[model samples]
Target: MSDAASTGFSADWLRQREPFDLAARSASLALGFRAALGPQNPAAFRIVDLASGSGANFRALAPLLEKDQEWRLVDHDPLLLAAQRSEITRWASGQRWHCHDHEGGLAIHAGPARWLVRSQQLDLARDLEDIDLASCDGLVTTAFLDLVSAAWLDRLSALLVRTPRPLLASLTVDGRRTWFPTRPADQLIADAFLSHQGGEKGFGPSLGVRATPYLAAHLAVAGYQVSTQSSDWHIGREHSDMLLNMAQEAATVATETDPSCKPAVSSWLADRAADIHHGLLSLEIGHLDLLAVPHFPVVK
Candidate 1:
């Protein structure tokens, strides 16, 4: 998934991280979200995915739903929105499902289950209010919360409270990172990355790793029962490309955050590269998945 901010994410990067995202997500939270939707018409079950990226969240959750569904994928980047149909179509085809263009979107058929997907381009920072959560059975987002500000989360919580729908937010970073065979500059690099994470990403100052806790508190205060679970990424030696990307990005951020650390960051990156070459490197990045549902009054 991608952030709603104007800082567009590369589709290639999103694709590369998708498998890890899928593996890290909490199936239990998905089940809880499905249950919260209750006994709705199977053919009319609807979900709205925020910052939908190339539709990874839809692909991840659709099978779990096991019902005929409609998904509205909302994102700020037209590039990502444009990529959604092809990605979903390819995925459906791989699953031996029938997929075709229908009404400017895509319709997918998997045995008795059918999914209708459509894309909408909206600047989430400005057009968040335009999403009609009341019309959807559920609201979902992935890898997006960390890019938003506390006030943005507050607005989201207020919206959810008013709409009273179940929400599943997956793969939000939780600030923890572990690298195998730790090096001397590891903490320095991590601290730099964390600082970079707090920089503006088109959503004012980002909440970064603090996003989930802040949002959870707001939702709880609004009478929504919230649950969270770890969704950390465990990158192994086999995932050399991913590890290399992580190391490179960290080096870039570290240098940018403190130019004086350039030599140290470069040395660290070189060592990590050697580790990847020798199949001696591994990494774990902490993330959290959250599910929140409004409390419903029981009838006597």
Candidate 2:
């Protein structure tokens, strides 16, 4: 796999998508994960975020969690891990939270809440077992599941069952793509995009759209009570930049998948670009948020 694929996503792409990711996440599911953590020392609620790109998952989820949060943001890319502190600091400052270095990590104070975040650069494909899941109150990942293979998920399932904890996996692609002012080429583009998604992404052949369903089923069989909710992105005309990126990416992938489709993809791209320019384009990309908790007494 290429460095970009193996190391993880670029900070810029992650930044561009952060708002959409945050907006589309299921707040109810997040709150449920928080409840599953049960009561703990307000000063020591730990969470392990796998493939944490630029710490957006931490930012999106921290406030929704307990007042005191300790997050281990794990990723393979040193650059992304390195960028975490500044990104987090800027975000904290914007929120009017006091952010400072503490114990080789960042300590953020949001009113009465305290959050400590530490970045760990470990290739999840090799060092997933190295993570001390038992020590953390919960496990959370965003926009990561689809890139993993079934074998990897099986390993994760076994690990989770061995040391049970609530898991909130959000924004997993579910293979649905809807474009406004429908065109026949949309189906063609969607099919090619899904095909491209199944290619190796540093995890053998990726599960792609099948990721959430497969993980949910495995976790359920392991006696986890899993619930899923739609977290689709509803991109409107105002999000022309995002729309353009989506169109270009789709065209590129579609052409790569089948050279014969290049002409069609080029024409489709032209039409999409025109639509975006005219403020007539909108899109909906399907995603799912899954919360899996061990079957335990309900927490009110």
Candidate 3:
């Protein structure tokens, strides 16, 4: 995946934007998870976080579970994973105030935590084959699905269903273009850009806002019950500027896909950027978070 697509997990742009906070949205998901598990009694539940990325979700999820529970994080970026480990170590070493779940004795396992995060070093998508799927109680990923194509989602969904555990995914799809301070012209540009992004991913464009719905339908058809909710970034100046740049890039991509869009979309983006620069334009990026769990099959 390109740096832009992976930004939510890897790019300094999003790190600067504080994707770790994005994991807070998982609170509801964790509740849904406990509900699905129906009483966290005996054995500690095991969770696999795909594209774990600096342990953003882990940070959010760490405090909410039983200490004995094991969190098996998977990410292609070793650097981020290392950073995650560092954070974990820092927290683990802290006194009562540092540990989020001291009562639970939470253990932070680090594959490699320290230094620059690398991608190819730990590709979860392909490396996951070695995992014992049946042993996992739950699977999770945040701000990840939006970067994948429908085909990729289908493949992932199939793998998810094949596992003997429920899947709790949080894919933050960009919905800001459709809401307040929304520039109709910029919206069109964004659409064009998403379409181009799809092509690059081997999926035809037009899957932007529809990704969650599409995924839900796919999972439901596979015999899983799904729940969805909207999570807004509530853009501050920094976030708004970051999103503005993203919008511009998406618009540029759209213009590239269809040459005719160049004259119109380009001018619109330039003006939009100028307006943003002048503190006259603003937009909030909306994202959808989805939770999917298996409908426990009848014992009969």
In model 2, the worst 10-residue window by lDDT is 1-10
> Model 3: per-residue lDDT, tens digit, 29-140?
7788766754435656666777777666665664555344566667766667667656555545652333333332334433222112112234544455655567666777
Q: What would the TM-score be for candidate 3 when compared with the true structure? A: 0.73
Clash count, candidate 3:
6
- Regarding lDDT, does 2 or 3 come out ahead? 2
lDDT (Cα) of model 2: 0.88
lDDT of 1 by residue, 1-300 (tens): 233222569888899999999999999999999988774644457899999999999999999998888999999988999999888888998999999888887999989988999999999998899999868888999999999998889889888877788899999999999999899999999898788778788778999999999999999988989999999999999999999988888887788899998999899999999999999999999999999988974111
lDDT of 3: 0.59
lDDT scores in order: 0.89, 0.88, 0.59
Q: Give the TM-score of candidate 2.
A: 0.95
lDDT string for model 2 (1-300, tens) is 111123256788888888888899999999999888875645467899999979999999898874888999999988889989989999999999999889999999999888999999898888789988768888999999988899999999998888888999999999998999999999999888888788888877889999999999999999999999999989989999988988888888888888999999999999999999999999999999999999954222
Worst 10 residues of 1 by lDDT: 1-10
Error of 3 at 26 (Å): 5.8
The best candidate in terms of TM-score: 1
Off by over 4 Å in 2: 1-8, 40-43, 296-300
Q: Which stretches of candidate 1 lie over 4 Å from their true place?
A: 1-6, 297-300
Superposed on all Cα atoms, model 1 deviates from the true structure by an RMSD in Å of 2.4
TM-score of each: 0.96, 0.95, 0.73
